[model samples]
Target: MFAAAAIAIIITMVLALIRGFIGPTLYDRILAVNMFGTQTVLVIAILGFMMGRPDFLDIALVYALINFVGVIALLKYFKYGSLSIGPGEERNTEKSSHMDKS
Candidate 1:
């Protein structure tokens, strides 16, 4: 059963990689990459259980947190060209506007 789950995850990961590579837009690619990262976390947890090592869950947790933060950062950068501040930050928005004009 675990093997079956792993195989399914592997198939999904492959599909996600393909999507990431062939996505029509940057957002599609970003979403595909995020999906891949999430699948990786699940795979790591499953592998840990199969190997009788619980410590891998810690790694999976860290990966998940990093993945969440990374996706947010990517989206923020795509929208504003930087993640230094929120969308309503006038100073940063002004800076970005200036940069765009350059």
Candidate 2:
């Protein structure tokens, strides 16, 4: 039933793409995109099994790693305004003291 599973994953991938495009918030879109990437990895694995080629698993693993890092980097950039974090540098934009309320 690998074919069935592949079909299911492709359907979910379509759904994820729709959600990513039509999400109400930035986080929602990011989550959807992440889901799509995960589905892609699954698809790759399934295809590899169907074709009897084990090498695709390696490519899928690499893609998964890239997807994870990409999402994390995107989230950090959106939250912190930059990816560069120097040692001992304070990047906290939130007010720490109660009296410092703006």
RMSD of every prediction? 4.3, 5.1
Which number leads on TM-score? 1
Instruction: Give the clashing pairs for model 2.
Output: none
TM-score of 1: 0.83
Q: List, in order, the clash count of every candidate structure.
A: 0, 0
Tell me the RMSD of model 1 versus the true structure. Answer: 4.3
TM-score of each: 0.83, 0.81
Tell me the deviation in Å of residue 96 in model 1. 13
- 28 in model 2: Cα distance from truth in Å? 0.9
Off by over 4 Å in 1: 91-102
Instruction: Put down candidate 2 lDDT per residue, 1-102, tens digits, no spaces.
Output: 999999999999989999998999999899998999999999999999999997899999999999999999988778667789544444656556334543
